[model samples]
Target: MKIIGNLFSKVLILIIVLFTLMPDASLVMAEETNLALKKEVFVSRETSGKEHQKTTDGLMDIKTSSKSWNAKSSDSITINLGAILDFNQIVVYEYSFQRANGYKLEISNDNISYTAVKEDSGIIASTERNFRTNAPHYVGVINIEKQSAQYIRLTVTEVLENKVSYIEEIEVYNSSDPDKFATEDTSLNASTDLVVDSAFGFKAPKVSKTIEENYAAGKPVFVSRETSGKYHERITDGIKNISTGGHAWNIKAGDYAIIDLGNAKEIDCVIVYEYSHLRAKDYVLELSNDMSSWTTVSRVTDYVSLNGETGEKSNAPHYYGKIEFDKTSARYVKLTINETAENKVAYFEEIEIYNKANKMPEFNAQPKEEEIKLSAPVVSESIPYSKEKFHIYLFIGQSNMNGRDNIPNSERVILKDVFLLNKEGKWEYAQPYPFGTKYSDYQGYNRYSSVDEGTKNGLNSASSFARAVTDNIPDDIGIGIISNARGGTSIEKWQKGSGEGLYEEAVRRTKEAISMGGTLKGILWLQGESCAKKEGYLDKLNQMVTDMRNDIGGIDDVPFIASEIIQSRPEGNVTIRKISEKIKASDYVSSVGTNTIDGLHYDAESQQLIGVRFAEKILNKIYGVTVTSDALLASLYNKEIQTEEIVPDYQFKIKINGKYLITDVEPIMHENRLFVPLRAIFEALNSTVEWEESTKKVTGIKGPKTVVMHIGSQNAYVNGVAVQIDVSPMLVNNRTLVPIRFISESLGAKVEWNQEIKTAYIELN
Candidate 1:
């Protein structure tokens, strides 16, 4: 029975041994399989060639003869070497009889096709003669994408004139084993020593007993030592040191220390300290994952200076503060004193690392959805003003219609003080503000207002009109001039339902003013320059009047007075005649003639005359007051009615290939036989009018070209080319009228007049 029991026990022990042996066998087979999968082969050419030897001092000298060459005549030297080899790297050395210019190094797989690997600059010839020596050359370091290469070539493109080139050495290294070609093991002490290349190794104090005692007592371990002749203390609170100057502990030349963070933590910052009085410098702080393969985090010179200036005296301690890690997964941190002060040592009192804060809370808050509503302005009902009691004039159109022509001075008439109601409902006087001022030489002629000339002029006119109308009626006349004008703006831009452009904004503002309290009386329409450029000028003008009348509380039929655009200068009579024709035909709109001394804008005298004409026409229709032309003439300093010879039966005849076409008119022949007032005539001719105040020129466009006729200048341009006309166009009575027949035919538009309808018409083919 005892023998049987002993045998059973032996059997059990054998079973346990076999189980352990089975795992070992499997592990060995697995390692073999892994090794077999990593197939790599290394090919080197050093052994077969003439061997060049180098000394232990890291320098080499090689000698080669030209007779050792296998020369080819195809302008390329091909080296067929290792077979079935995986090409990884190549190195070559060459010596020349003379200075070589350069050489192209190429690599190939099939020995036929080649790719240039590197181009090397030739070395200067050495003074040592007998077989000239050049500086040692490292030809090419290539990383081949494909693993196999059977042949490589070096083609010398340009060489120094009289030299024979001899290769001293060529080495090709390939690896079939990946592990052999991988980065060298740098974690060894030999590698570290090689990196430092110095003689010192670090040591530290014995703290095992103290650490064990602190762990038993559940308290932090403290290290106190005298370094650089000063006593320093360091306390570790598991992961970090809470005490100040923790990293400031000093150590001797060959001394080292370690701070165990107790557990793995995300390290955000690390601070270092030096000896109490001496500054620290030339040190390296590194981190490691497995207490090996350390990465240097920071290195700084003594007296940590950012701008390379020493801060030793600045009370700022010579320490590296807040050393951040690119990642937070490190377990061991190592600091090495690379170099230090000649007399003072390096030290670190305590190290600290912080984990980042939680960021998930910010992402958790989501805004609740809610209904939204868009608000729009409420249109108010219009308040009617009796014409017999009070008159409200709406000064509309461009800069001239606005009142930029009047100079502001005490000599000028002050009718009433005008104020603007700001968005906040505060009343602002029309005094000199930063944006608007006449005293600064920023006037109508300066184009500063041309961008929005009509708007600027409208504001000035409204202010002046307020002063003038208030002077006559006093308290009874609460003059409200709702102006809407944009300088250089065309009438088409002001059309309703054309999304709010500059002109639309003007019209909107005017309507808003009228809705608030402004009473409708007369619309002083002073715009035509933009319409003067197109063929359908009258139709567009008629459209604007119709649209504006419907928009401004249906005040279309309420005495709309049109101011004829003033001619620039030099030929004022011709422009006046053109303006007169339009005014004479439209009973609802009357012409306010050009009343300026210089002609660009209406002067004070002209402004008063314009006001009188507007008031007479409006008051007569609204109040049944008969305001005669004689009565209007009496108000103008009793100036005599300047009459010229009336051109009776004067007509324009257009013969296009012998087919007669009569030009439509209210092209009335004003005194001098000049057929004027043909908005339709100019429109049919495809001529556009643009007024430039700076040059005082009215420019006309035909097709892809321009013609500029200055007010005072006689020379004109046809498509930027200069030409002369018989009569220069001018501004008369606030109207820009040109000679009908002369300008019409010159612009390729035939002009003719119908004697039966008393009209002028233009025809274009």
Candidate 2:
């Protein structure tokens, strides 16, 4: 009996000692419950520099120097007074540089020992200069993770060639563990507690709570709890240590404490903890950047009670709780404790603070100027067109097709029916020709015609010809004339794919037309001068025709017609013969010879005759009209032997010094070039024509007014003032072709170019 009593006394003593060292069981339970609470820390950099070190006052400062240090150097430098800090991340901010080169980062635990963390050989640490006031600076971010060091050093490997390297700032942060942190809570805490009932009717009473221990200085605050009373609340009013002004009651299973933050920088987040009890609803969290502006972060209403009796109870107690802010800028933070059930009370334990983080600057580059010019216009809707029978004609090839004649008069023709179909399937009608003439004939539309003043007449002539031919043809005939003709331009230009050359433009226009729902039929080619001047005339012509045919989708053995070039004079027959021979020899093309009084252009009669001839030969073939023989052409060329008396269709009567003079007969459209019979007109105006063949131009001097005309260019000079002519001047068959009617009438002379006899007559008015 004595031994058993001694053993029992020893056991009792041991139990007392264990009880003393174990601390209060309730306090241990409170700590265990709060351990599941989560925390976060956010750090932001706001300045530029290389070295960012914490000062004795705990404020961070960035520093930089001019000395270039090798970042890849094995030599080490120690940082003084370092601590063992658990840093999950480090971000280095750098400015713009031509290339990324020369930068190193090192960390050290002891002042005597160091470890190289990051050694980048091609890290350029420089801020780009902004010449334009609106140009933005470039920035780079260097992330250092899984690195254990208290002190960090950045060393430059190589200095930039022309620019200086700059670092804006560096940031360090400790990552938070989410599993260890609670995202929801059920206990009644002041910061996150929300009331739903009035069972424990607490009237407009402001309650407060304090968390006195185990608080990190710069960690995010989390909260979780529930409430029921009508008027219960708490706030964290600029007090980081403790809260006052609330009754300290025996907190039961669901009671809560409240904290109030006074006027300060905005509160980004708040935290709360429930010691042991469980509740059903979630917590309500609110924040304020300014005390006046309040934003509710979250509401906690759905929670599972971990400590319920059967693990299926509706409101069991829990320990861990957390609430996070959506990275806002704020100052004052507050919490409210709602009343619980009659016997239930809320519990509270911990609070934390998170500093506001900085944001990175955005960079967006601008687009180039040339690209802006090439952007196609937007089309709202497509025009309705038959997809089955839309035929596109691609008119490609040399100068004649390019239309290098004179500009037609404005009264010449109103091309109402002619239209160029745009990519959006919309039609754009051709404008009236801007010159002074009486031949206002309707013509088919021509696209991509030369705009140079000299080419207007030829283009107008072509238009008239096309209109006459297609008038009764298929309405589905969509003509896309990609006339990329340049005078004195060679086949090489089209072959070279140079700037604005006919080949590229032709291809582009053809593609555009086709994309707009037009099917390419054939290419109307009329170029050979360049090839004729050189040797490979046949080969070049063949290649050009073949390429065009292939590009236009190889439609029905694409037929090409070679227009026989007229002579500079009626006697220069060498070119005509060459053209005829080449056309007759080629299997894919037909030849149409035009009559020319001059070596350059065809007269109106010749133009009509040639058009008819071409229409008969090529159009007939296209229309299934087979020619039995080539005898008719031979007969027409050989049988023209009679000379008829030239009668003036219209006579110009003018008063020259009040004297009526019927001047000598003048040829209207002479040498394939239109001549104004300037001598008669000038004589009528008391002036004379001065010829300068060396300049390929003519000058008419009449009473201190000098009107100059060039053979191939659009602009003319009248008395030293530049005048824009509708049509370019031309020299045909040793005759200086001038705009007779316009010049004569404007210079006080009445003149006319007769259509019947094809002669020009002028008189001074």
Candidate 3:
């Protein structure tokens, strides 16, 4: 009985030990509930397709026999997870190269019915290449409320530019799983559709929004773009930790993320937490009563290294900074990013405005030296408001001068030495669409504003021209541009002191640009298209130049370079070129052919090239620098044409001022050289043509200049002076054909080509 009792005791102890060592049954079931979104388990199906079908059925392996769900005819795709699982997030991998514009996610326990979870619109395709994915890959994560779903559906509602759409892979994440997809309450201020750059994935800050709110109890502020997520809120939400992501604003220079106080409020101090990884440098803190006008309170230009200043890293990736001011008040605050510290991206974590509704000190009252020292932890010296010794150039003209080309990616970058007197009457990094459209009739002067007050805008050549000039000149020389061109304005409107018109506004802007000791170097004029067919336009142009030179400090002999206007029809081109010839003949006014595509306006590429020509003219005529060979004068705008044997394709479309020519004899391409019937094109251009049979030579006369070209020879004579041509004159189909450039240019006329349309334009001076 004792031995049996001892055995029972041992068994009882063993049972107790087993119970103590066993895992929690509830936890084991929860672990099984938290199963990862397995790719193999996802029985994927897609919208039907004629090609690349069954491709979206499995994993995103491109090497296998893959198929794609095309969005050619249909614009929706539905995926079934095949089993009920608790999930909240769906991740999709785009086709190897194609992308969808907009899509929405829906979930349902029953496949017949689904609930909408998340939707995004205007999502741009990924430009950065990921070799691991074998193409430009972008991942879209759709978040939903925690729920059990047997099926999930993805519907693409919009496509960009009708581009081919497909999905390489899809993933479902359980929202309840903390390790994979934790639900965070964050409200995004910037469009979430534009925020897919986090390929490495993002970890929402572990700290609660309440922590930041407690820190900003009294000072009130609102941001233009806010972070929208469960873990985040608008700028006023008092987000302090880097664990919570920041508010991403527009990345362009001079674009600001504004803070509205609701009304004019006095504020003396502000604390800012820049993005943990990316942040702005050389920014501005400005105050304003009306959003239209702003006063710069501080300019922060201290160079913060890529990871931020050493020892100042409170949040590892985030940099903490403070901006303190002499006590003042206003309703609106603006943080204008002049530049990014490292990347061309901008974002901020939190901002605290202190001394709410503090009354402003008396105006023009100088503070005691001791008062300035105690305002902030880091006191900054005020940046001087003057840009001394900068070289300023005035840009004025009609539509093409105002700009017609859309800004290309290559030209959108910022340059340090090149600056523009922005529409706001402030110097900022030069950019496209620099002209101010709206003029307040409040005063006789141009009190400009950078705000887009319903302005019609496009990219112009002035910025590029300034950039080129900046590239060629000494580094010490700052290049400034005053863009005053108004689209579709006539010469009469550009006359100096034309009483509250574009010209008067232009003069005001020019004076404002040179107010701080910058030298007015020259004027870049591209006009005459509006009055291309008007009589006595040359006289009007000459008078306008004379008036402008006098108004801008009576500087005689300032170089006024003009462009041979482009026109849709040949006759209009002839009429404008005649006037352009007179301007070119003037001592101060020079002319170069403005390259065009549609026969009306200079395309972006041509505008870039023409801007280079403008720079070349500036170098030669003003600075006396040699851009090409010594023989090619800097004043010569066609210096590039003289070097290259064959010009770019866009240089082939020709226009005479306001008209495009249609002739019975088409221009011929021989041995990579362009040849046209000498008589047909010239006669259409209003020039008298004669053929000398004895020498197989043709002589064309327009006004004072005569052009002579002989058959089968590249030698041509302009007013008795011999010049070399690209191609020799030839006879074909009983018509005499000559190298049009040589013949046309020799007669003091301008010739241009439109590469986009494959045509030529000729203008007789």
Candidate 4:
């Protein structure tokens, strides 16, 4: 008995193991064969009787009933399955009413031989009378005995109405249980369109809205305003509770987003759900096979925004709306919101695209090349340049970096030692407007209108920066600039490998500049305003620097310096501070600026000053050459002010670099010291004067230094450092006056005051 029990337990264990390893029988039986792929078709004569026949006009369109093929009276079409296929069912679709009383199906193993079903056989009769009213189409499913045949013939016969027998499409099924894969009535004109293949004769319904639905479920999206993951974040999070408190993809006019559908699809309509209380007034729908290239499909100058409750709702009415355009096949759909009705932010809660499956073959039509007659070859003279003698720098960023301010007369003259790599990729005498025709490749990334024009007014800091560098460096070493910048661009545009990305173009131009021969010294960047509202700017900029250094070979440790945007509004203070701190703390960046004018861009005077500051940074960091503010002043102005002492009244005469600073106003005694007009000395030192009424502050700038003082204030700041003055700056005759000794000495200039001779001397450098 014990031996028998042990043997029985071993047998049970073996049985359990065998059962665990067995394949699923249900899954194996559920698989069905599809024989309607890669087949050939032949028709006796098409209804149109033309080369362009409607019989083969994408009868497999599957989604919409707008396209159809017609067969009038006794029209027979033959289909070669290429191999023997066992099919149990056949379905035929009609665009209009069913006029054909019967369809006779014949099967043949060889094209020359055929076998037809007898008339008495019940396979050819149908009276279900089911039709898709919204799609306006009729389908007839005919059940047939399972048979294997290589060629099948479908004939429209037994015409009942006026000898007009129209067949929109046809399909065949390989499953023994024909209902297993039948097109359900619920799928017609429903949320999803049923896609059927009529060519191979299979009822395979592909989901037409798959592309858009997949995007909402987590696909990549890019926007002009926000290039980071933020663009797709709000859309794909699946949180459609569009309460005013929740996050949304908010944009202003001229900002747009691109939804990548992953592959090409025949698209016609798009649905957009806007944020509460905000709707885009104008929008453009565009399509593209390649993400880099795009063609506009439709433009909606005025679109209605709606409000709804829950599940894609905003506070406003009709939060969701659909837009239809000319049918087009594209892999990418770009929706650009041009303007908003209330001038409110164009915020979107969700966006979905609807497209049909592309049944046609892909054929990219190329433009024909025009024939050209060759003329005599022209020889060009080569200009010689020493590669090692040139020190190159790249100027990159948005409008402020491209320089919107006018160039001052004192700084307009072209410096012989400085060269500009213009848009044409040739080096010329360095001047303002680094973004010219040569650097116009930046237009590919610029979404703004003013940013693309080559003839637009541009005055950038590159020329001034080059001039300052050349003034400080030795004559043998020439300075060159690769100027590539666009106005109203964000840091996202500067990312690498992005289609129509400025960063990719910048690196390409940088490499091109390097090929022309030169030691790339550094990069000059001055942009931040566009992305100030968002975070992660530091990471994006750092990655850009790394990519540039890696792409532009032989410049691994190139220095990148940026400028702190002038934050004129209180709201921008934190963002500006963060950007400034990041720039100052970065290892790739050597130095950043503290100068700005009007908060949006630097003034003309500050632009030159910033340029001098850039030179100072390069000189000190790269060449180990120390540059003082006084050096910038002396090199920039080259003017002199004379001073004389009057012994009788104990009055002192001051001279500004061997010339008189003021011929109209003499030195006035205040608190036992001679005071001079602030503008007189500052202008003589090549500085600019501007008064801010909002802050009651007087700001003066001269090449790398800035003196900011408030009216009736005893304290003043020089280059953001605080210092006390013996006599506060006073307003006399609507001009600010300051103590000569303190202002001159603080700017690294020599100041001398003689009590007996009443004479004062000031040397700039």
Candidate 5:
């Protein structure tokens, strides 16, 4: 009995220790439930081949994860956890690298309101990598802190063109568990008929009464020419992520895609997202009912012609094209790739077709070309408004300009005489909504009272900007906010011309707004988040500024405030601010957002602040106002960010054999050669310089020798002898810069460079 008692005592103590360290058995049983297993999941949009399948399979291993779910671009998936639960974390599971570019995880209970939990690129982290069991290596697992929700949503921001965004499985837990997912709630489980895909599976969402449908989604695609790859039908595969097995079809120059809608349907719009970086061809879209005769539906039709003269290198931004016209009936739509760019291919990813009557609720791209034309009448005879005193401000950019942050009723303001351009091409009283749709899409919808607008119906910087502009001025001096911005759109999408693209649309609207007897006070811009990491952003931005100034009158006369973006990515803000320095008439404002809710967008307060800044900057820069109506506003806006004065960036102090020489254009070093203004150094040596614009030749004449160099040529002629220069002569602010050492030495001056103090000494003895 004593021996038995000893063993029992030890076992009982062990049990006590286990119970103390581990969670209470009854508590775990009551709290730990896999809320998503067999629960009803809803997807925003479901295509044919890449459909939403049974993701609640209660498995996270690699093999079973093949039964994945899919969501289209800018589409979302929502899962109902049956009832509200105080869950602390969400553990989403997916395969490796087989995903889109970005996605957002959100938590909500009522289904109408949502809070973005995590909005990161769906890439796995080093700590989350688990090659043995799950894929994603761990992009799907998002943690929610001090939060409770019964419903969760995941939205795919940008997919690989037409590729479907996929995920293996999603599991919600009460704790941040690594592996142990407790048994699901039996009461919430239901018999599902959705088929489990053999490989990354998908089941189409059942047709709903109100779901915005994609007509050409998952339809049969027949290419005019196909390469060796198996992606011949990828156009209709509804796959937006990378097709690693094969690239999208861009094999041959004349390759085209023919999408069969399965039945004759009326369509007006066709949008295509191409994969290749080079595609500067005039694409033709034709529709047919009998496959014999075709009717041309225009747009991006004259690509090369629309964008001035070709030979300028094309890029990926030009490929995301859309064509909209009068509604037409057709069963087959064909897209032909133009064959202009040699060595560069036109790889296509996704194509969507839509009718005017069945336009997606969220599709407020650009109003029809005819609608933009209708603005003339409104400008002529619409309502009672002043043309001279009414100041027109064009607001253009990406979502930040379009408004992504929610605004409370307290923040909502509708000023008298302040107007917003409506879809009807008429100026209407500014609405209380924070977010602005395309000028043509605004139906005066107000969401401030409903409250908790989330990302939808939020306040835009333009509205706040307008209110700020109108507050101090006389009642007669009103402002019009022309909202023309699209979310997730690259700056390339706003390229000049491109056949009724956003750029041309903005130009037309600006002209129309001016026709309303309003002076072009200024243009407010906030973009660059899309291609912040893309190369040649400066060149593209300069081209946009040049093109806009060329198209709009007085655009160069006013302050083109290029605003910075959120702190999440500092590259865009850094790059965009350079425009103010590069362009004389332009200026920049600091980002008007802080404490970002999702690390991507601003909240209501930030948007209001943005408006205040725009008003302050425009008043300070354009109107040359030293004092604002409010003393605080003047102080806030007058805070200088970057000085416009010409300052030495490299801290260079030029010395001609020890005498400091001040230059109008700062001397910069390139290719190990210190470049100085051709006239600055040449004249310092008493040498006269002559420039030939036609030949791009810089000729410097000294007492004994003469040297010649082209604007962008490294090869030069010194005393009639050929010489290879290390750095080419370049033009800056209309002042030509040439290699100082090469030019000074060629002109009989000894040149010495100081590495310590960055002083260049030119000796002329």
Candidate 6:
């Protein structure tokens, strides 16, 4: 429940105490003792979970695993030793992913002021290129003539080109002997090994050629002695798919981890997967039958960090080193690390012995799914039945408002008269996504929806709210959704006068929805993920609500509701719950349901439950209209289910000048010519249009230009001149669909067709 991070999200901490030192592990400190252990570590900026405490955890003195302090725009790390010590050496390490390739060490006496160490005046940075091909040089050690200081600061001045900064452990050693820790040559290939974690083979399977079974996995592992890091039992635990840090047995040079394969058997191939960042170069492998007599299998001595042997760590971190030889019959296999690829310590993720008996874990690789184009049902300007009220709501804020529910074509919620604002700013019958899913139609929605490589990236809170609200109201009444919710946006963006951002975009969409005929009954605010840990969110949110009321014309007494975010963000949840106190009518729904694709975003069932909760608050509190809840309806609908039917391949767009021609009826392609609704495009061209239902004819008039066309007729009259057209006029969804090219050309406007993006541009005269 404790979230240890910066006081303010993304804000840098200059001077603060973040940790309390634990009881002293060592009674007296010497050159062999790590003075930095159980001390306070202060970083400029650290991400959540990767706090500054990890830097002084004493896992590995110079090499780090997943236990690291990941920085955000970090500049330096200051370690407080609690008391002044005459230390001669300070060792700092970079991470497997974030490589602080260059750094400088500074000492502070007052803990407020600092000066560079006397041994080094310039920065300690490596000029090596293609660090992936060669092991990354990520160590910065300064052995100064014993200086008395309480605080030591390591400033990461330069980073590996295009790489981030992740600080691992920092070790300080005090010595009475002056020549204890001297400045050693650090520009060697076989000394320091650090690289990217996203490399291909870090957690992926890499078996030896013609080898399928692993005889050592899940077997008992016995190490000769304890090493630097932790977890010795992981040497035999399968390590192909999971790459967690602080795992595996960390052994000093010439130490061995013995994997007991239950009983002895014939073993031909031995593959060792060492920690990718700190790979072991030289290792002594032997086979033991009775723990006394042993046959030496292989002793690696000249391994050059696997630079040219495998793919670079930037692209593919070679997790395993394969050794295939003649079959050796032995009950036990001993892997003794003689030398490390980089530092003095080495760790193994997995060690597999092949004897053609036990098979590895089952791996089922699912290929990425292909997206099929789907066309939603054609929505009319207004519903067929009338005589009822039309309520509207603004679904605004962060990712929770914009969601993904794996609702199939059957569970996909659809009401009779509910509507969703499309990405082109038009209205479609209420469904999961109002904004078009395709990039060519509405690219912005696709940007957020297709972020994850999963199938459940559809559905929002608005559709379910509409269904619940409609059930409470009259049968003929309907709802139109003005959805402009952007995921991961802070409340600051929604505040009015924020300038040219989501604020302006939300106001524009609301105005468009309002202009189409509906009341802005309420505003649904579901943001604050970006600034979850920050303070002053309640005041900012109040300002945004007041501004939205003033700027988004009409309905001053409308209800404004905020939903409680996931329990993970407790601070943000507190702020959201406090909004009800600010606005008398507004309500805040409690966080509910599980089944999230990622633990962050709410899943479909949860999204549906949230929708119903919001609607319940609005209907009972805002409208003062409540009905006894049907437990079955709230949980699962037992009535006849309504399925969603989408007309396939029924979309094309018409752009006049530069702006999109937003219309209720979208343009369609027929007979190689684009057919758009006559009224919308004519009005865009400063032309007046008239339709005759009896004759099935339409006429467009702009200044002196006049064009006439009849439905299902191939001949058209423009300025009283008869012209033969390739495609006839048509009627679709009760709207007069006309050939756009013939109409634009007759009006003397230049029309250009772009096939790549599937749009027709018209330059009006």
The model with the greatest TM-score is 6
- Candidates 3 and 4 compared by TM-score, better number: 3
Poorest lDDT segment (10 consecutive residues) of candidate 2: 34-43
Give the per-residue Cα lDDT of candidate 3 at 621: 74
Q: List, residue by residue over 445-472, the lDDT tens digit for candidate 1.
A: 1122222422223114344334434433
TM-score of each prediction: 0.30, 0.28, 0.34, 0.32, 0.34, 0.38
**Alpha-carbon RMSD, candidate 4:** 35.9
Better of 2 and 6 by lDDT: 6
Which pairs of residues collide in model 6? 66-245, 191-342, 200-316, 264-331, 399-487
TM-score of 5: 0.34
lDDT string, candidate 4, 657-697, tens digits: 65535445667888876677777777776678787877778
TM-score winner, 1 or 4 = 4
Candidates 1 and 2 compared by lDDT, better number: 1
State the lDDT of candidate 6 residue by residue for 34-148, as single tens digits.
8898687777764333346667876443232334665433378888888888788776655433456455678997889898874333334322112221113245556687788
Local error of candidate 1 at residue 84 (angstroms)? 99
lDDT of 5 at 316: 17
Give the per-residue Cα lDDT of candidate 1 at 489: 55
- Supply the TM-score for candidate 4: 0.32
Alpha-carbon error at 572 in model 2, in Å?
A: 10
Error of 5 at 735 (Å): 37
